[model samples]
Target: MNDDGRRTTRMRDRAAGAAVMEQVVRLHAQAPPRSTLARALGARPIGEDTAPWFAGALGEREVGAVLDRLPEGWSVFHAIPVGTRPDASGAVSDVDHIVVGPAGVFVVNTKHHRGQRVWVGERAVLVAGQKQPYLRNSDLEASRVRGVLAQAGIAAPVTGVVALVGTKEVTVRQQPRRVLVLRAEQLVRWLTRRPAVLDAATIADVARLFDDPATWRPVDSSADTVERFAVIEREVRTAQLVRAGWMLAVALGAVAVALPVVSVLTR
Candidate 1:
């Protein structure tokens, strides 16, 4: 997915959809409608020229739905912008998902493709006639996420996960190491599974950080791209109120004591 798509995916976390998501919702409502649009923006639609784009939307919706089901406390972060790292050609990568918590940091790659055959092996996800090197990329992503967290002064283990969305047929030959494969329905369980390495305190800390929108990032997860404007409108009017209430009381006490002393001196 492109950058705009990633932003739409994160918007879903707010239980709110952007213009593109609204368009998709409208498309869903209208049947006998432009089936072509569905092909272009939904899950894999056969013979659809923009199946890739539609599949991407489906992937974001699926992944977002799964992450949403987690209990209120579990912090789920998507499409984080890590600092940067060099690739084989010395190009730095901007990885996809970063789930940071006590269970550990997880790097996730969301794949939305439809086909009759699919297999996830040691280093590749084979779907129909093509293959995506998920293992290698996910490992690299995990390393990058770890490095980013380290820069934040937090030491934690990192894992990789692949979230697949699409109505396409899928079959796996073997489970890949350090990677959790999941569909939309199984997201919470997949995420909340006992960690192999991270301690509990660190996990809670990671979750806490994600709940704050201050550090949240916006990125595209769907194929349909859009111009981005990162504006957050908050209603909270936080100020130094009750925290200074004690000081006000202290000043009043001083005035009360000084008044009596001054009256006696003047008289």
Candidate 2:
């Protein structure tokens, strides 16, 4: 086929991807709380409410600071999805913040943990006191974003950085590897030091890359993945409630059985 036909195909693919992704998002949103998960383990909820926030309040604040200093024409993409499929991985890595500046696309992961000693690796972030599985989550996100933009016919460099936000007690134990790990204060200064490789023209062109925000969505094939998981969750809850009611009924029966015995003994 001609150029237009190829472009149309890509557009349709992206749209379908986006639609399926939305369904995945909804299922995740309806997920059980950590407290509920804890209860499954015979534990209580440690915190007040269970809605999860990876960045939390302070992470959001510091990111805002970094965004405030960016060049005027630069566009900031907050919580942009980059998965080839829907349903982002992990609690926090899914919606990375991307700042499209004149130089390149900057993919940022904001960490909001305080009093944590962080060891930044080439592809992993060690948080609090434990090392997690290594993966260049930010880089992968940047790559996916580039792919999306490429389909729109724009080629540009994408860079990944992790910004530590609200970490007043954070200490870096080692030098950063391929990734640039810094606090929000440092990130602003670093971004301002150099002009972007992609200026106004390039940023604009890349922005228009794909017009399909719908189509092969997050919920397509992935819908079952989330739905099955949800069914499992609901079943667990139902089982718990059923078990609790049974126990209550048994307790009432015991009370009834003992009542006459107790009255006769007393008389």
The models' CA-based lDDT, in order, is: 0.53, 0.55
Off by over 4 Å in 1: 1-51, 83-96, 195-200, 208-267
| Model 1, CA-based lDDT | 0.53
Clashes of 1: 14
Off by over 4 Å in 2: 1-58, 84-93, 121-124, 133-135, 169-177, 210-267
Candidate 2 lDDT trough over 10 residues, lowest sum: 12-21
- Which window of ten consecutive residues has the lowest lDDT sum in model 1? 229-238
Angstrom error at residue 243, model 1: 63
Residue 265, candidate 2: C-alpha displacement in angstroms? 56
TM-score of each: 0.54, 0.54
Model 1: per-residue lDDT, tens digit, 120-196? 66556777857878777777777766665675677777788877766366666677876766554565686677554
